[model samples]
Target: MIKFLLIVNRQGQLRLRKYFEEKVVTHGEQREIIRQCLSAVDKQNFLVEFKDFTVVYKKYGNLYFIAGITSNENELAVLELMHHMVETLDKYFDRVSEIDILYSLDRVHMVIDEMVVNGYILETSQPRILVPLQLLDVARK
Candidate 1:
């Protein structure tokens, strides 16, 4: 099972975070995790083992998509999930960037929520996943 997903910039600023489990982490622990993630990605490592979880991360421009999963989870599948997420965002934002994500965080979270629920992938089809968001856009206009 996946524990959490984090989007962090190169400078170690967190752009987004979503926790699938109900575990509570202290602020210091959260910061330490982010630091470890930054270092892991900087070394060009795709997978890193933590205390009780494994981190799978991919770099896109200056942003890093990181997923923390149980030790038994498949790293490649999580990697593909991150790639699909980036692709979906690219399609929606027309060349997605950090700024785009910062500005439309709600939409971004909605997209992530549509794809994942309770640490499990709910949908892989981008069009089907985006339909509700598109409808929301139309309604807002």
Candidate 2:
């Protein structure tokens, strides 16, 4: 199972976070975990295994899209899901950036909700994820 999803910038600050499971640590500890994870990787894609969970992350532009999952979960699958999430965000925002995600936080969360439920991947197709968001955008106008 997945533990959490996080979007952190190069500055080591979190842009967005979603937790699927129970809290196993305090806010500070969580921050520490993120910090450690970020520090551990220098590449665009990586999987870091911790004591209790594993981190799968991919870098996009200036932000790091990271997901935490149980050790038993498929790392490659989680990584692909993370890429899909980014692509969905890209489609929604035209061009994805930290500022775009910040401004469209609610919409971004909507995409996240559509893609992941209870830490499991709900959809993989871009069109499946984009249709609802497009409808929502049209309705908002």
TM-score of each: 0.93, 0.91
Pairs in clash, predicted candidate 2: none
Model 2 misses residue 68 by how many Å? 1.1
Model 2, backbone clash pairs (residues 3+ apart or across chains), number: 0
lDDT of 1 by residue, 1-141 (tens): 788998989988999989999864556777777788777635657887767888788889999898889877889999999999999999999999999999999999999999999998889999988898899999999
Q: Which stretches of candidate 1 lie above 4 Å from their native place?
A: 41-44
Q: For candidate 2, what is the TM-score?
A: 0.91
lDDT per residue for candidate 2 within 40-70, as digits (tens), equals 7466548776657787888778888888888
**CA deviation > 4 Å runs, candidate 2:** 41-45
Q: Per-residue lDDT for 87 in model 2?
A: 82
> After TM-score superposition, what is the CA distance of residue 11 in candidate 2 from its true location, in Å?
0.2
